[model samples]
Target: MMDIVKNKTETSNSVWHVEHATLAEWQAVMAWAKDEGWDMGLGDANAFFEVDDQGFFIGYLGKEPVAAMSIVNYSSSFSFLGHYLVSPTYRGQGYGLKLCQSAFAHGGDRCMGLDGMPAQVDNYAKWGFAGGRNNLRMVGQVQQDYHCPDYIELVQAADIDDIVAYDKSCTGIDRSALLKHWFIGETRYGFICRTGQEVTGIVGVRQSQDGYRVGPLFANTPDLVEPLFVAALSAVPQGRQVTLDVPEKADPTLIKLAEKHGFESIFHTLRMYRGEPPKEQEHKVWCIASLELG
Candidate 1:
């Protein structure tokens, strides 16, 4: 059983000790997340924070994990900061401030991208993060006749290199390593769009509480997104719901596509950054892999 709380005699300021998360802590963290309605996928959390990472911290009040966060290093391109969470019981007790400061210290001088929740924008802005693009969480019931283009196919291990290469150039942040772990290690479906022998687009679909979700959906053009969406949705179990996140500035066609397919916006967020935001186009992002990792 996980320890629910711990108090130390060394500090009077309620100093929360933050450490790396263990595989077994999934139960404790996830239970708290479910209780808070996060729709998290704890099963995938292990692989998501693989051994190769430079930062993944869990805050403890005594012996209990009360807050957690990770900073993924990306060299000069920019590091991504995410997985920041404070347990419900310990929130508003200065634990979140410690967690955020620790996360920034871990990230160092690199720029960070985070989809700040609506309520937390002002709080994050106080930390030097400026609002960037909108990250909309959209959902819809699967349409029975959703037709996939013939060229898309199931991805193999060998295709990872190609996917990484495409992802590196398509997005400002180099997330090649995370892509490998997310696509292969998490047991999610990897669908690739091809034009002749050339790989043109890629998408990943994973299971969540609401049903299947398509995330990190990357393609060269807005036109390619329709086909990619079809391929991603095709992998979902019949009768289950399908959801996709959309970047606010994406092609107007995408909104029509979502509506035509019966999808609706569930919530939206501002992708904020401290210092300068990256130069890549948020308009092309069709899905956010997760709030924790994005």
Candidate 2:
């Protein structure tokens, strides 16, 4: 186990140093993350590092990594703080609070946001986060005899720009590079719905411990979103389970459809903020990519 208590014998400077994570450090971080009950995939680790804009860090009590966090300078629009963790042995110390302050400092002026756990809202409030909207983490399965949705198309690398534009309408912030890394570069199945010459909706499915997840599922309406969901589930193995993160305020039709297919809440989060609340999207945001990334 990790020896994390502060050494009473040593009186060195309060050097809770932090460093940018290297690819070699990923496995250690991933292992530590999962051990702390954080659900993460190997591919997710790779994509976060490759995006270049996301900053990953490990904190040291001396020479070992006892804490970790990441910052996604999503775009000029907004930034996100996630993957925040403290080694089991290190809990109750000031490490978590320090790491969080560091993340926001690193993210700087880019309208930072994070999905704070309900019980921890007070903790985040001390750091400037306030409750805003809520999102439900839902799951379901693909029909055994699935029919392809006519408007849904298999996305080509060339279609990334169009997809990014469509994503912005649903998520007030534009994380284009992060989305590209997630849907195209990572081990995931992605589909999009187009209206004439323009792409209007998109959904991505990736393998998960429970089954498959349609994360970052963004669309313009119930009509456009339904087809994308069908396409995502059809790509998964037969009878495979699936999940999606649907916002509570999305179209009632979308909510019923997920319920019709057996999707229910695995968890819920109060999407909070510290500063002035950001504008909520007017378009349909049926699912979020992942709690870790948001």
Candidate 3:
């Protein structure tokens, strides 16, 4: 933790504090994200917090939080940076850069990754983050009658271990803690496609502010992808919109699936990483869990 006063003047004398955010403070960060037009899923904070209790940092000018960032060290050699924000009134005063410094320090020598808004891609690159794929945020109304394949089954608590193992195979990260919280919420829905007890595909969808979001859509083959997607989409209520973030360079079939379902690309983010990107089965990542988490 570090605290400093900028000047002797009354207004500038207020101390600027930088440290890990408490649970309540983390909720405040989520509120900031919502205000920024990010449609975060309900119960996201709890799962995110569990990943690394000390990973979220907030910068306070006196008693008011002015900036926030998260550097989730998923493993010794890899981490993700996200939820980076500075209050509108506090921008241009270097608070954002200070928060970034804290995130980088916490990340240490690990390869850091972030899904940066298009406008900030260059800024991230200037900080040694190289651009990778552009992720498209596709949105559409859920198709109530979409058909789920016969092999697909609803994911239950008993299947968590298998789901987590499947996720690790796709992402190469042990995000079991996140998966645990992510799959059990009242408004959440998850399903898996299996063959003779072997999980071949999985997808999870959760209610969001606007509608719902599908993610962590991992599949062993393209043939299984659409069914898993349809199963997740069918879980959403009729007439509600759904969103999915798909990596442009991953499975091309993902784009076709989105189009067939009448999904439109409403937003995009640049995937950037400092040092080499983590090795994962990118093709298996039909839809990312979340830009913030990934």
Candidate 4:
């Protein structure tokens, strides 16, 4: 509701206008995303809405939704851009660019992050998103034979602080609210590895539209990964495919483990930032939390 598409990017500035999203509109947009093979998590819209109610938006062409996007500000200096979608019937009409510009404005001076698909890299770059790194999407049936290490335990509600700090160390984003809510649903399974009383690692998997996704897989060393991976895999419903978005350059072990467990290569996205990049503890981040949120 801040402003309409009057920035001159649109062919018909009067026709298309972006407004803050309602939860119902967000749900409808998420459904479109699922049908388009994006495999959105079932509760993603609700979680995202709770994180920043004003972050999501819809582009309306005379009351009909034609585009959608989110610019969730996690803190004073960090924001994430995602779920940018334009209706096929509305694409090529400049609605996407208009919507994107709105997101850019909403994010303001925050250092923004996005996992841009191949098709959108140039578009994102046009707006100054730079320092692209690949986030590989690996899929297959990983081994379930590994036992949970004696030091590992299911993530309890009281463990949120440790998990949030651990997650921030690797990603450089203080996503405490999102991380806490991530484990609330029944489809979510998370675990933490410990050394004595100290938390050393964390991993979680959640069911998406198509399958389960393993993410925020952070650890101090390679020795702690597989056992947690196996523990996460145990929580998914039977017969569902497994996916791990690998930051190959950041952590080489993920790809090797994926291959060892029969995972095959899929597509990848470029992790790009629109301002000064974050000082992430990349070596510890085996997989990221989400493309849409990171």
Top lDDT model = 3
lDDT over C-alpha atoms for residue 129 of model 4: 87
lDDT of 1 by residue, 27-103 (tens): 57666656765666424566555523546667776677788766766666477666667887778877777766655
lDDT of 2 by residue, 1-294 (tens): 222224322316445766677767756778876675445543776666655533777777667777888777666546677777788887888788766655566667667678756666788777777665677767666657666687677788888888777776667666676667567644577888777897778888887655677777777767776777778778788777776666677356667878887777777776776555456574567778877666
Q: Best to worst by TM-score, what's the order?
A: 3, 4, 1, 2
lDDT value, residue 89 of candidate 1: 74
Tell me how far the alpha carbon of residue 24 in candidate 1 is from the true structure, in angstroms, after superposition: 3.1
lDDT of each: 0.70, 0.69, 0.84, 0.80
The candidate, 2 or 4, that scores higher on lDDT is 4
Give candidate 1's total backbone clashes: 2
RMSD of each: 3.7, 4.2, 2.5, 2.4
Candidate 4 residue pairs in clash (backbone atoms < 3 Å):
none
Q: Is candidate 1 or candidate 4 better by TM-score?
A: 4
- Model 1 whole-model lDDT (C-alpha atoms): 0.70
| RMSD (Cα, Å) of model 3 | 2.5
lDDT of each residue in 186-264, candidate 3, tens digit only: 8988898888898999999998867898997999999988889888877888889888899997358988888988999
- Model 4 spans > 4 angstroms off: 1-14, 142-147
Q: What's the CA error at residue 109 for candidate 4, in Å?
A: 0.9
